[model samples]
Target: MSSLKFYNEEGAGQQNSDLYHYSQAVVLGDIVKCSGQGGWDPTGKLDANDVEGQVDLAFQNVNRVLQAAGLRGWEDVYSVRSYHVDMDASFEFVVDRFKKHCPDHRPIWTCIGVTRLGLPEMLIEIEVEAYAKKA
Candidate 1:
């Protein structure tokens, strides 16, 4: 089996720092595992206090990571897991946002309510897994 490669693109990848202990997107053979993406801006700061803005930012973060791995948008995502601090607002925001961003290709998704995240101001975080087409 081939080893995985991680990327720490710093602001380029929308991550705060370019020094991730691990790779941003690990490519193990044909599968790519992306890290949890939050509602942080390109500077790594949370954008808004509300669920709608936060959810949009989270998807933007995920899009950047996926692009870094040379893949398309949500269509490349095989599975997704979202962590929300407030279920009612955050869940609805995510569902609506997903419907708009990923209308046709519905990937497997899981939404979980959490007490807290890495940052206190962060309201939502999303992680994704994608499969690369065979070469």
Candidate 2:
């Protein structure tokens, strides 16, 4: 049996966990599931006007958690869930980001539209799950 473990790296990852009371990612067996990551930068800055940049930054944050476990980055990821404040407004940016990130193949993905996110300036949040292939 595999024990449950929490993953929280240094810098912004640790800060977010301390303030929010949640791990950046959780691991059980061979699966690593990350929390929803918003568009804010490492300095906690969010740009409301840049949808594409925000969405891309969200994925970057997701990758940070996955990489913390020494995984194969986004390539090891098999599932993704994104929350958007406005799907219609951010559809193109989201899809464009997917294409750029997963150019070789597509993973299981779900995009949800919500009224708001953790931060008012945050327009997109992304969550990802990766396989560790541990024995």
Candidate 3:
């Protein structure tokens, strides 16, 4: 059996988690499960004001979490789930960004429209599940 390992965000993530406790990601053997990441940077500030900027920063945060779990890059990602305040607007951008990042690999994806997210200013949130289960 693989034991659970927690990877708490180091800087602003740590501070943010103080409000609500959770890890940025977790590891169990060869699998890495990352938590929802918003457009906030290491300082816990909203780095991107628009949906396009937010989507870009959110992906960066997801990558940051993945690297923290010891994974190389997006090729290790097997699945993705995103939450958007306005699906009509965010849907296209998220898909395009996914293609840009995961160019070599195509992973399962799901998009959800929500009333809001953890942060009121957030436009989108990204979470992923990755494994060494590549064929």
Candidate 4:
């Protein structure tokens, strides 16, 4: 059986992970699972004020988490789940952004509209599962 491997970005140990008690992502063998990421920067500050900008930053954070786990890019992602504050407003933008990022390899996607996220200022949260064969 393979053991779990965890990845947390720099400064996260003393900042986000310590305060929130969560790792950015974990890997088990060929599969990688990541915590939902918001538009917050490394310091946990909201980087984007609008939905489009927030969606862009959230994807960047997800990519950062994936790279930390030794994955190349979103091309390794097989599935994605996003939580949005307003489905009506966020739905279109989210789909468009996903297409923009994963233009060649599209991951199975699930988007949910929630009453709110962990932070009130956050407009969207994204989580992903990716796979890469042992090399």
Query: Tens digit of lDDT per residue, candidate 2, span 13-130?
Result: 7888898899988887788988988887876689998887788778888888888876777888899999999898888888888888788889899989999999889899999888
Lowest lDDT 10-mer window, candidate 1? 12-21
| Whole-structure CA lDDT of model 2 | 0.84
Q: Give the alpha carbon lDDT tens digit for every residue of 1-135 in model 1.
A: 256676544573534444444455777667778888888777776755677888998898787787778777577888999998888878888988888878888889998999998778889999999887776
lDDT of 4 by residue, 1-88 (tens): 2478888766532266778787888897789998898877666678435887788778888888888889986889999999999788
lDDT (Cα atoms) of all candidates against the true structure? 0.78, 0.84, 0.83, 0.82
Query: What value does the lDDT take at residue 4 in candidate 3?
Result: 85
Find the 10 residues in a row with the least total lDDT in model 2: 1-10
Best by lDDT: 2
- Compared to the true structure, candidate 1 yields what TM-score? 0.87
lDDT assessment of candidate 1: 0.78
Residues 1-135, candidate 3: write the lDDT tens digits. Answer: 257887765766667767788788888778899999988877878843589888888898888778777787587899999999988878899989988999998999988899999888998999999994534
Q: TM-score: which is higher, 2 or 4?
A: 2
Which stretches of candidate 2 lie above 4 Å from their native place? none
Q: Which regions of candidate 3 are displaced past 4 Å?
A: 132-135
The list of candidate 1 runs beyond 4 A from truth reads 9-20
Q: All candidates' TM-scores?
A: 0.87, 0.91, 0.88, 0.90
Q: Which structure among the candidates has the greatest TM-score? A: 2
Between prediction 1 and prediction 3, the one with superior TM-score is 3
Evaluate model 3: give its lDDT.
0.83
